[model samples]
Target chain A: MGSNNSLAVRCRSLVKSYGSGDAKVTALRGVDLDVREGELLMVVGPSGCGKTTLISIIGAILSQDSGECIVLGHDLQRMNETERATLRGGQIGFVFQMFNLLPSLSAVENVAIPLLINGTPQKMAESRAREAIEAVGLGSRPNVLPSELSGGQQQRVAIARALVHDPKLIVCDEPTSNLDHDTGVAVMDVLRGAGKKHDRALIVVTHDPRIFQFADRIAHMDDGKIIEVTNGASAL
Target chain B: MLRVAVKMLMGDRAKYAGLVFGIAFTSFLVTFAASYFTGFMTRGFALISENPTVDVWVMDPAVRSVEKTTNMAASALDRVRSIEGVRSAVPMALGTAEVRFANGQFQSFQVIGVDDATLAGVPPPKDGVVPAALRTPDSVIADPGGTSGKLQTPLRPADQWPGGGPRLDVPTRSLTVGDELLVNDHHVTVVGKSEALPRFPPRPLLYTTYSNASRILLPERRRMTFVLVSAAPGVAASDLAALIEARTGLRARTSDDFKADTVSWFLENSEDVGDIAAMLTLAMSVGFGVTGIMLYMFTTENLRQYAVFKAMGASSRMLLAMIFVQVALSALLGTGLGLGLCAIASQFAVEAEYPFRMMWFTPLVSSVMVVIVSVVAAAISARPVLTLDPAIVFTGR
Candidate 1:
């Protein structure tokens, strides 16, 4: 497969495993996937079904054992550690299930981290972070620590952090698994609205089914492989 | 990112204080031990330091230090004075004398006898008293160290008993001009007080003429302990000393060489040096242990946060830099605080006449030790963070 302008990520027959000898466990076995620009792609599976592994490779944080995994016109296998870190810092943003905001920092400071990582000036990064937080309805309390924020508010801060750097690709893992039903839906609304842009792709890996309607397309995984791909309500 | 690292470290106030306290304690103890050792070594050569004008000291070959001397025959002074580079030579007698206060209190003192003609080795008296004061018959200059302590007598005759006997409740005062004392049964009068450097083993000092010393101290055939010499205007002290040693078959050393020999003897024979070394080693080890363990605990507690940073595109180098900055700040702050505490304590030590002197290189040495401690701490703490897998951020707990 050749690179495609429309596709933000393209993977073919990717394989990854952990450990060695009798204790070895394969995490991804010849997995093929495509995430298109301007689309919200959700990989859903039961626990230990390689949803994290697939998104980790696409996020440029983990290397595949074999096969082709290209992210944003760059082949993952050919990039060195520094190049991969530059790719992740400059082009990709991540949101996690734990809403992993550095607890020592205020909400705005946490949101400004990705931009700071990308070498943006501190004043400009914080200004953009404040704007992103405002867009997510967290403008009133940008100076509070993460521990002081509610689960829903912290998730909104995580979304603001992902969008503040204006990265071309955003990877989210179990973004709503730690929130309640209504809060999870509200967080999804904020994430999908602010995160997905005309030239960007958002990949969310979730076991939570409550936010299924937010995905433009959902890929179901089982035993280290993508078993099926289906369009969600947004796509229809 | 540097701000973030600082905030993370300062966020936990208790751990930050603990780390700083460990380093500060180490610095204070190490500095204190080193300064005390330096003070003792300085005092080890107090007699040499007192006579700065003397270029060379000629003594018997068996004399290693001024504190442990072997006296020479009276002819040794003539032998040294006849050398080509010798400008002047004076006899110096060092001996212990038992002095009886007016109230009959007996105390031992180190008596130094200067030459009658030049008074070469006598420390200058306080209050502008001239060297000619030694010319008075049976007159000696009592050092402040002696007068302030062992030479104190009852202030008034009435304070003593009716028969001039000692009274336990009498108010006492240090001896001054016109005060008389009995030295080895000979009546001697204090004509002046000398400002003398403190000595190791802390003995009171009395300076008198060589004739008076011969009478006051135990009689011996060899009366001269050393021949103090001044080199000619164009002569180097070391060269003059070598020439004297070659011609006279006596040991001759420049003042500096004699001082070094004194310190070497102390280091080889004294337990004080060993004790100070052990204390210094203990302080450094404890500093390393406490700081290293505390830093490792701090890093271990924040491993997940580091993992989050790692997952958020932070390279291992960035994380390492953060740890280094944290440790550097702690080391600097702790060193400053420790030195400040030592400065305060040294004031009290001086007032109490304790051996304490902060040499120029002491702070520099302490800072280097603290840096080593901080580097080791940062390395120990960074190991876990550097090896952490960012993938752990995806896992729960």
Candidate 2:
């Protein structure tokens, strides 16, 4: 563990159930995890193994039947929807595997969305978006739309969007699953670079093994529970 | 984000064009149809109304409007002229006469006989020429199409006496632009052409001096058909109408009241106004329908992106704002184009002698309708977008 002890994301005794009695399907059972500030962590699991459910709960996009999820020092269950959304906007960023960029927006415009949503003036938001896009090595492609970019470039734009708001935590759901191996590595490099430069906690949830090398730590899960945890030294 | 939504709506050339086209077409139908209804109502009382220069219009207490009915009396004209606010009162008579065109065809015409000294109730041409008495009693001031044989005066079908062979005969004498016409064998001359006015059941029109019409239409009778009242400046027509109504027990109405009454009469008596209103309503409905469909498509197409925004920490308010902005922008553009088209179309209609005058509220009202429909459509489309799971983007669901 790093020396600094600021916890960016924490979950304790999280219990999530799908149904009751005979047809019950437990997605998360008695799980606990802590992600420290400035660390890049990868969550690996087989399909339907609850890695997604854990990330969802941490992002405040889903609710756990029973548990405590304190993300960026705010308890998810204690806040109302509006309060939670406000906290989410102020403290978190999200990147999707599909590079969910708005088709109507240009690369720079897509990156400016989070700032715009947070009520930043358009000029300032666009300026900040430009910086984020440049950080992802897309300095010259700011005006190109998602459709005009390759898979790798699209994901870079998604990364630029996630970092544009300067949030404390970045939760990425399969950020590189759709990309080819080389493009996926390039995207992960950009993500790790941003995480380290910004000193924010990054949690990437995916089943892709190719992305494991960019993470400082890895949590392995099976059957709704973490089976093993390893550091970057051992992951390599 | 508003800029983004706008760019998205305009990004696809075909879709944007289609959306604008649909909206403009819907707007055209709404304005055009409404204009027709409004124009028809205006035509019902256009004769007495087209002249705003006349300060007051007085009719018998029993007459709702100057066009629909008449009362026999020359006494009211002299009495009205003696009132304090009255600047002048002129005797004007509206009657139907048979005009024999040069082609030997005869047609019914609306003949307005006004006093030569004070053409108070006469409709002047665009150049504002008052109709004067012709040198001869047969001459008449006529509109271009007023000479056509197609002109037919509207009258109750049962009012015609079956035994009376076409009550009046065609003038045997040939007439020129300034020549006299033997109307009912009484010679009357053409003064000059008055401005063309549209009538509900269109007929050719003629304008002559008041004395000649008094003798021709009421050959055996002793008074004018109606006396028009003109109040002095600063006097209210309503007060005058009240004065005339109280004194004579004749149905006296202000000009506006008279016009409105005529409109109500036509709406009640004829199916034209009602049919036009129904068609205008249908057009408005179709406009709403088109906007709804276009907005629905726009929202549905952008749902996934909306979900992404939500996942990226955008609130429902922000998403809704984006939608409203997109729709408002589209509506403004469509309304602009539609108003332009309506203006062009109105020019053609007017040139063709089809009465169409666009009101000031048409564009404002139509734009409001479009925005309302857009909001409802956006709200419906937002439901699916609001429910989309952010996790699905990764899971392939």
Candidate 3:
């Protein structure tokens, strides 16, 4: 993909590290990547590679050490913490492998949090959260706590939370790694349906081959760098 | 967000309860301790506290407290009575005398002598109206020590060592209207037990007539320890005290000034109340530490949630406010539980006649402390969340 008016995320020669001196661990080393306005892209790699780190940098959750990185036409490298938080909150969504739904909140409330953080009125957020949850196919269990849900069901709730605020970009880090083979496929299908919108883009970092069919493009990472970009799972 | 914050706390049932219990224990300790110590301060002036009718107390110029008095000339009573604005003056002889108990033990007492004609400054006999004041030469009245027979009619556990000191538990048998005791080797009958001053290190108190007390005390000259005087109508006790002081050349203090003098004396001379002060200090330190630690652990455990909120665009101020709400709510809930316990305890303390008054200001002051605890606790827990990178949500770390 190329950086154009519709590009949701763009980066070139970005770098990042964990520590300093003898303890330093370089996580990202001069990587370039792009995703159009409406696309479902997956970045896959081995466990120690920088697949998660790259997605984290793209999501504005982590700052790169040095780079030109732009998401939704805004340069992340130049922004302060407060501005980055505002951008991430209003424009991005994140899904995790562990399905980090707060144990204290019910499924709908967990899904409603992003909207609440975005300053939507609570009643409106909850009503929208119900629709988002229903879209991901858990309408009957809106009030259930995360602990009560099965692995696949909880991931679906995580997906609902990511989609509820209608962000321009969604990032998933091993979103299906915890589920069984069949359950992972099911969750990937729901994520695929939600990610392929004209105004939004999706990026999933995964090792699971079962859900590779859902990605419009796949970026392979190795040793803190992107090694290949394939058009679809057929290039696997 | 604050509503969610509270619901979040309520959701963590086991931890929430633990946090509340910690705060409740702190609250109970501080509130009850303050009330208890403030009540104890009044015991320093228990003398005039018992005799509410006496407006002015005339004693020798050297007298500092009722417990530490010097004998004034008996003629000072006549002098005070003749002063302008003086309504009446009656001599009261207060002295410490040794009385032998049935246990073959002799205990010392602060003996009181009331005027035979006026019976002024004498607490009424508990069972009946005032009888002829010490008609018999060798008769003495005992004080039931503020319990007014509660100590006799089935003793309570708290009264066993009430006001706790060595040699204070000397009342082996309760006194009655006709029991005989020896005061200063002189045989005396217990004419009637009455309610007297509430004192610490509660010694046995004995009362007799002015003439008989003069004989028992054997002061070097004809003397009375004090002249209990009242102000005439439309006369301020303080105003009348100056006139009596000028006329009698003796120390004349209104009840309030005398009470203040006694308080000042006790504050300077007494080391016994230091235990209560120490307990108060311990309660406050523990309250601050325990409540702060519990809330800190609670916030540290929930640090990830705050980061997630931060990642989701909640400002540091907003998340900080949420944590503050949790701390404030827990403080109020716990303090209320502790105060309820204190209220129940106070009823029994009052009934048992232990000086445990719960002043209104204790709760007011404790609430302020709770506010401080809330801010400090929240600030402690807010540190991790404040500097949080929000990026932690993206990594297993």
Candidate 4:
């Protein structure tokens, strides 16, 4: 989503090629996009349209071979892997499509992980994690494991995990891809509510057009490049 | 933290099993090998370990231990008798011979010829050796040293001499108890079975008069191979040894010195024993190495999960401590079980007549080996963990 004078993400000629020279797949080809602080943006595309790859680059989980991706005033291309990891942990939270919760941990424990990683005391982290879990409407099931929760409940736990650390940006990759339409709607509502309530930038990558209604802006991708950027209401 | 570590390790029962089994196998190998070697060494001292009744062993100056055959003229006995602090020195003769039993079966045996005068070892019930009886012309007493003999009536005084002469007649055919048999095919023996020192060897040992054994077994008979000397109540062994050496110019060894020398001789000369010991040591080392590698792999596999905790912000030191504690606890379980098994096996070995002795040091040595193996295993396993990127939680690919 574009903000008039406030920028949270900046990219320039970002190029990411997989594999060595002879047998390579270019996931992102010199595409650039900007996300605004406190904005809820949905990146929509068909499969293999570089939506996930672009999000990965923005979140500092993957590197671009050339060009620049600046997030929170730090250049992802120049920072070492370790430095990127630190920045990601400190400022970014993630919600995966499959709800990647540690199977051994309870919902609250899963949520507390990022906080724990950030050196929060266990008791304090778990308490904050409980608040986030409750905020997602699963207050009573905080002790339940991800496997024990419904598809929507699991997604909420993932969202809680991402938000409990109070990160500046939330990167949700296909947050509703594994859920039914009703559960997907519920997950998007929780994600939007949490994003707006905390004033954190939320970037959701998805192929499902139904969830575009929850986005403040929509960015469409095709042939490994973003072809259109518009207000979500315009796309609807 | 320890509880978490324990739960995590126990949660994957199969992985912990692999680590435990490796350590258990190593413990068995190291413990068994040390015990076996120590048992073999102890076997050499079984017969005369206590040094009963006598303190010093007088041998040829060249004889370092009992394994070496020493010779001294019997005339040396007189000189020993004259030495101060020397209570008495009894002459003993040792030789090897082929004995043809009544069944016409032949077997080689070691013979210890003692002075008949002392009856020092006459058929049990009679303790001291008597010269008067041993010197009874051709009369011979057999105190079992070689083959176990049967008891029979003492021979007739007149028959003690052969053809009514001073020497007895040698029998050509295999004979029964009381029947005359030639010793060295020379002086005949009135075979008398004694309970003392039975199962000594296969050949028949005749305890006859020194004079008779001299005439029968030795060409010179002027020297005796050994003199079992018991010291006076107040005289120390070194004093007696010095006294005897000064008077007789012969070497004297204390019982412990003789036993040690004998063991050294055996270790040097017996290639089979040394080879077995060397092979066992090599096998034990290989066992330890294999266990170490296996443990490292198990820990390596589990280290992926450790990265999850690291991503959770657990310190590298904390994670290492967790792995080490897990390994140490598993090793404790495995080694405890191994030692228990060894103890049970040792008991069975004793009952089954296997010469097995497990000294306290055996387990100590095994524990040290286990610790070393575990440390090496942890080191290799820790490599994967130390290099783990906490970013994997995010990359999730």
Report residue B101 deviation for candidate 2 (angstroms).
5.2
Ordering by DockQ: 3, 1, 2, 4
Candidates 2 and 4, the one with greater TM-score? 2
Worst 10 residues of 1 chain A by lDDT: A1-10
Q: Taking the tens digit of each residue's C-alpha lDDT, what string does model 1 give over B157-189?
A: 776323656564577898888888889899899
Which is superior by DockQ, 2 or 3?
Answer: 3
Report per-candidate TM-score of chain A alone. 0.95, 0.95, 0.95, 0.96
User: What lDDT tens digits, residue by residue, belong to model 2 across residues B1-397?
Assistant: 7777788788877888888887788777777777877777777777756656565566665566545766566777777776677667787778887864432345677777777676655555424444554425455676542234353222332322224445333333322344434466565555555556577666667776777666666464534666677777877888876876676655656677777888878877677667777777877887879878987897887777777777677787777878878777777788778878998999999887786867788767766776677778878877777666654554533
The alpha-carbon deviation from the true structure for residue B222 of candidate 3, after best TM-score superposition, in angstroms, is 9.1
- As for TM-score, the candidate ahead, 1 or 4, is 1
Query: Per-residue alpha-carbon lDDT of model 3 for A1-236, expressed as tens digits?
Result: 32234788899998989989999988888899988877888898888688877887888878899988999888999888888889888888888887878898999999999888878899999999999999999999999999999999999999999888888899998899899999999998888778764357889988888888887789888888989989875755
Give candidate 2's TM-score. 0.82
| lDDT tens per residue, model 4, A80-147 | 76677678778888887767776556898778877766667888988999999999999999998777
Best by TM-score: 3
Model 3 scores a TM of 0.88
User: In terms of DockQ, which candidate is stronger, 1 or 3?
Assistant: 3
- Candidate 4, CAPRI quality class derived from DockQ: incorrect
Q: Supply candidate 1's per-residue lDDT for B91.
A: 92
Candidate 3 local lDDT, B172-221, one digit each (tens): 44656766666777777777877776776566677788887877764568
Model 4 misplacement above 4 A: A1-9, A13-33, A41-66, A69-90, A97-112, A115-133, A136-138, A141-159, A173-176, A205-213, A217-236, B1-4, B44-271, B278-290, B303-319, B388-397
Flag the better candidate by DockQ, 1 or 4. Answer: 1
DockQ of 1: 0.50
